[model samples]
Target: MSFAADSPFKSISILYRKSHIWLNEGCIPCDLTAAQAIVIMIVCDFSTLTQDEITKRLSLDKSVIAKTVTKLEERGFLQRTTNPKDKRTYDIHPTEKAWQVYPHIREQVEACFCRMTQTMSEEDRQNFRRLLDTAARAALNQEE
Candidate 1:
């Protein structure tokens, strides 16, 4: 069979799509879609963050983050209280339920990475990770 020419964009696109599918399936037990699971993981890591903080960190649209946060709050995975320092903004925090599923969410994330790099040697994995980080930073126009 003929192979397609090497293209980083094509490879990255495929990886992004496939990883999302894999993560979504893995998160099924937690009753979360991939997006919700990701929001939970971020909130759990920070303990408390404003919706704007989450949006900036994830580089997602504000409306999307707002909707996700609302859904998470309704489902008991998160709690939102008016930020004391800024009454107009809400501070998002993971609930006991979110903590309960934190490990599983982390496991799914780790498993996805492991599967993605399973074929690579340890050194190759390290190099690939480093290169990917650099590329990401460049794409974001961030200083190294």
Candidate 2:
């Protein structure tokens, strides 16, 4: 069967590809891969996140998050300290370098999102985001 324009899988795949390329180019100055940059941003926003939390939030494999965190720690972009509440887990925190460039990264992400939704009306944008969020939550919940 031929793929249709309305296919959710195809649309999500296309969005993922475009977002990857955009983030990769945007993260060059930070010496981070798109994935790592995303993790850093999440950690900065959350202040304290564990590797498992990142894996869940990003819908990525635990090993991938572990490797990305290792790289970030190596680059001094983040710190992974033992979690006081959970002896078996480590809490991730963005370091000074991450905090310094966070504003730029945040601005780029916001601008990119704005550009992507520029043609949509306010209500359309709201509905689009709401649907995506709901879909994401459902997908995540389905895995558990």
Candidate 3:
């Protein structure tokens, strides 16, 4: 299909949709949606983070982060403890369950990205990543 020469939106949207599907499918064995897997990975990486911190990191709404955290907590993958310095806020920590599944999640994420860039040479892959980062920053109106 021929796309308009001036626009990258169509290609970007298609890539986003396809990548989302691939990631979602890849996460099924872990019993996680892509969003849940991402959240777990972030919390695991950070060790402990507040809902607001997660919200900012992922650029997602506070309510979405709260709900995802609550679900993870209920599923035994995370624990929420009252922050020592902040009585009103809770710090999120990964539980044993999350630790157990961490490797699988990481593998799936790695596999997905590898598949996405499989046809590209190392140099091309690096360039693609740099370009994507530049585009993302521009879209977010951030200084490069």
Question: Which has the greatest lDDT?
Answer: 1
lDDT scores for all predictions? 0.90, 0.85, 0.86
Clashing pairs in 2: none
lDDT of 2 by residue, 1-144 (tens): 556467968867877787778878887887777788888889999988989989999999888889999988998999989999889999999999999978878876766666667889999988988988898999999989
Q: Write the per-residue lDDT of candidate 1 for residues 1-144, one digit (tens) a residue.
A: 322257767778877898899899999999898899999999999999999999887778999999999999999999999999889989999999999999999999888887888989999988988998888777666622
Give the CA lDDT, 0 to 100, for residue 32 in model 2: 72
Best-matching candidate per TM-score: 1
Model 2 TM: 0.89
Assess the local accuracy of residue 93 in candidate 2 as a C-alpha lDDT between 0 and 100: 91
TM-score of 1: 0.90
The full ranking of all candidates by lDDT, starting with the best, is 1, 3, 2
Per-residue lDDT of 124 in model 3: 95
Listed in order, each prediction's TM-score against the native is 0.90, 0.89, 0.86
Q: Which sections of candidate 3 miss by over 4 Å?
A: 1-6, 134-144
Q: Rank the candidates by TM-score, best first.
A: 1, 2, 3
lDDT (Cα, tens digit) per residue for candidate 3, span 22-137: 87998898899988998999999998998888987777788899899999999999999999999999999999999988888888877777777898999998898899888876
Between candidates 2 and 3, the one scoring higher on TM-score is 2
Candidate 1 local distance difference test against the native: 0.90
Itemize residue pairs with steric clashes in candidate 1: none
